[model samples]
Target: MTPAQTTRRHVLVAIALVWALVCGGLGWATRSAIQLDSFEAREDQRRTDEVRMERALARMEAEIAPVLYPERARPYMHFRSYYIATEARYRSDSSDASRDILVASPLKDYRGPDWILLHFQVSETEGWSSPQLSSEARFALPAGGIPAPVRPREAAPENWFAALQERYTAPMLEQVLMETLIHSGEVEGLSAAGPRPDAAPDAESGVRTAAAESARRAERLLQMQREIHPASTCEPELVAMENLEAGSGQVLYNRETGACVQVYAPLMTPVWLDLTQDGEPMLALVRSASVETSKNCTLQGVLIDWPKLARELTEQVRDIFPEVRLKPLLPSEMAASATVRGRLHTIPAKLVAARSPPVETWGLSSGLIGGLAVAWGATLLALVAITYGATKYLTLAERRMQFVAAVTHELRTPLTSFQLYSDLLAEMPQESAEKRRHYAGILRAEAARLARLVENVLSYSRVEETAPNLRLAPTDPSNILEAAAAATAEPCQKAGKELVIENHCPRETRIETDSQFVVQILTNLVENACKYSADASDRRIWLSAAPGPGGSITFEVDDAGFGVAPKDRRAIFEPFRRGTSEQGRRAGGVGLGLSLSRYWAQSLGGVLQLKRSSRNGAHYSCFSLTLPSAPRQC
Candidate 1:
């Protein structure tokens, strides 16, 4: 190569290196960005899921507010009443003569949430009493200490304290309540008669002193004026306290002094009583918060079915967290369940997502992640495009250098013949006409060789400049084959080979292509066949035209030359590339012959290819030209 060409090649190499480096950096950055974006997206989705879980649990807590603090639903559970009223109503709407009556109570009917198993109450010197017994039956008991209302208040309680027998069979609720009083230490000292399961305390008659005794036990804790004492009849003229709604615990207050006395905590046990249900499950008991007495408790609160209720709560949060768990707090976990307010003893259970929350692959920032991935794809494609362009430019340059060397070698033989024949013709006698005709023939053959070489060189240059100049016209396929036989006839004769044409085209079939290109393409193929197969025993070059696939005309040039080596097949049609066989080495034409033919064929909208085939188990390469067949009428 020239020094200038070498310098140009070095510059191209440097440019390619710089481009590759820049592209590599771009690729790595794109990959990193995509990875980082995916990580951030997953993190964002995880946080969103966590927030969703918290909100769902908060909504659940608000929904089950009444269950957590039952006193909030029935404030009388905190008031000082044995059979506390859940609801109250006035006997008459008339302001003058109106007495308040309890419309609902635990002892009246099991009107609490279904989650609660049962409700029962125990009074001082009185055992357990459920709503299972009618008011008449309860009042008819032998130790009945219940005040039988006289005169105006002596009204039928037929509609009050209806039997709750349907909820619990006889003795089942009664038996559980009796056991509760014993276990809770309430009946031992708080109840004067304790639990009399068979008789039930105050069943028929006894110390109408039960109310007095209960008041005394708790009176010392809340020392106050007689007018404000619970045992004293409530007079509206005395204090200005309003009945609070069920959302807040009921309280007895002296609005005059702004004092709140006996909140809801006293009427219901603040902690679970026999909640674990290790043995005979006990009833819920209410120990007055006003009176700090151990065995000095008063009444029982409602019992709840913990396991079933917990499962239901867990079910509600399953969508947020598939493995969510809602469970009663064990003694050890109870400390954690109670928040900073120092254990108000409302709910002692916990709800939690049992497993780590998962972030879906297709999540919150999926669009961003997808965009980053597209950037990575773009970077890789750009690198591939740059690399391909650089490689193609370098390959074309190498083929040009090879073309220059091959052409120099091609010009050597013809130039030497012209020199030898010119010197002989100048010195030969004027009378030797036979010698002059022979010399003239030899000169014409050599001139023909140079013309063919120049034609190929010019054709290749024209293809490089732009598209080929084509004159399209309808021409018979057989005519093209005959032209190729004539053009390559002299070359074949000199090489001791016969140029044969076989026409297999049906009549009326023609090609719609440039006839000149077709003939020149076939001529190049036949000349290659003669040069490559010069030593073949058959000494024949076959040129044929036939009907090809897809309604096209095919022209094939087949030879028994040395088959192309496996390695050379790929580059055989590449500009300036030649086979490594001994026959190809001896052939002296620039390698642009087949390349130019393919270019021209393609310009005429046809394909030129070396069709691999074996004739009678002997390998022979066939160069085939397939062109579009013209439309013709029968």
Candidate 2:
């Protein structure tokens, strides 16, 4: 095959390869996009699961703890000494499998903000009792936002003591004690003011008697003019003071004295609290399993502030309960079953703190999905990058074609003129002096034109190929302008246009740049201006150089001609582009001159733009070039 055919096949193969690669890359990218989409769905599901769980937790908390505590049942418990007894039972019946009596745990060691001691009394023969050892307890709860109820009027001592005598004094005086000699040694001493048992006096017995009498006397003094004592004939009323509710350990107070002696405690003890099981359980003896008790008269005669105590307890509960589980409903069937089987006990304070779902958890799903999408997007971007680089290779091939075509035409035009003129001068003899001189001038003009064209094409090719690589040299400002003026004089004179040098810059103001490139720029611009003004009799070309800001020099070439239209200014500077060419006017060149000049200017870190124009004979197309100033000599 011929060299031309080989070159064409190579170009065709290269173009086909570029298209094939781009197509394959794009297909791969598309597949990746689909895979990412599928993964995104799974990510969305994961986020949805998380959100559902959070919402369910919020619902559970809302159901369990409402915004406000009920208005009617608020009460505070006051204990002199409170105790909680816990006994593990292998079987349900306490009697079927009995164990030794053990020490009870004190519910709270000392007085806390919620409670205070009121009165206490102990028994000589027994551990403690409320009646024979008369005691009173006080508590405060919300009563229409008031502290407590008004204190009742004190009852007569005789009436209160008489009632206490019938309750306790009758129970202790047993049949054996009334008919036989039931001494203190056999029956122990009775409660003070009840039956006083007669027994022999010994060192140990004397100390016990003195201690019991001291406590009894103290109780009697405090209740001298109060309501019925602990062992009053109104014994039923006394038992009522110890009543308790089933769950929350809240108290009930006496309306008359604003005294709380009864409270609620957990009344059921399970071997294991079944979390999966819903609703209350069915079982016997559960009621008596969690019996609440008061320790000594320490529990009686106590005062409490319910609201303040509730606040403090809330803080304590928050501190103690730190972990929260996802609500069971939010998980998938398998996941939820697993969570339910897992160890779930206490919930975090935040779950129960508010009545609605927290706003912070709102975007839980979107955030997770977004993170996954970002990772997938990174992979997709790599595929797109490969496609972009391959496509750019095709564009480069097209620019190469344009370059070859433009360069060939540029060489051919001037070469043809120079060859024709040189042949005429060579054949003419010295005898035909004036004709020979004319031919010599034509030869010189054509040769110079060829030289300038070659220089422009070569310099512009270099500038375009390696942009920002400017070949700079410091020289006189006039050097470039003088060379351009000399080359363009013939064209200007032919067109009857005056080319003027308006030098505002100092003669010594030098610049660093490729002289050939500068001369080419001025030559093309001045030649274009002259040709465009060929119809005008009084045509003028203004070449000016001035000192610009930042120690730079600006060179401008202006021509009085049919100036460019506003819309065509930007479009005219592109390769193979021309302004709106008019009929009956000198045709513009192939339109590479301005485009090449722009490339040259930019390679030197400068710009070329149309400054201004006019409709009159002084119509101007300005070409300004700027470059860095050289350092001054010492």
**TM-score for every candidate vs. truth?**
0.55, 0.40
- lDDT score, candidate 2: 0.46
Candidate 1's TM-score reads 0.55
The sequence of per-residue lDDT tens digits that candidate 2 reaches over residues 48-102 is 6456445544444443233111101111121213322223244546541212322
- Name the lDDT value of residue 358 in candidate 2: 31
Point out where model 2 deviates above 4 Å: 1-395, 411-444, 464-483, 505-518, 531-538, 550-552, 562-609, 613-620, 631-634
Name the weakest run of 10 consecutive residues (lDDT summed) in model 1. Answer: 238-247
* Model 1 lDDT per residue over 413-479, tens place: 7899999999999999999999999999888988988888898888777776777666777788777
Query: Which candidate tops lDDT?
Result: 1
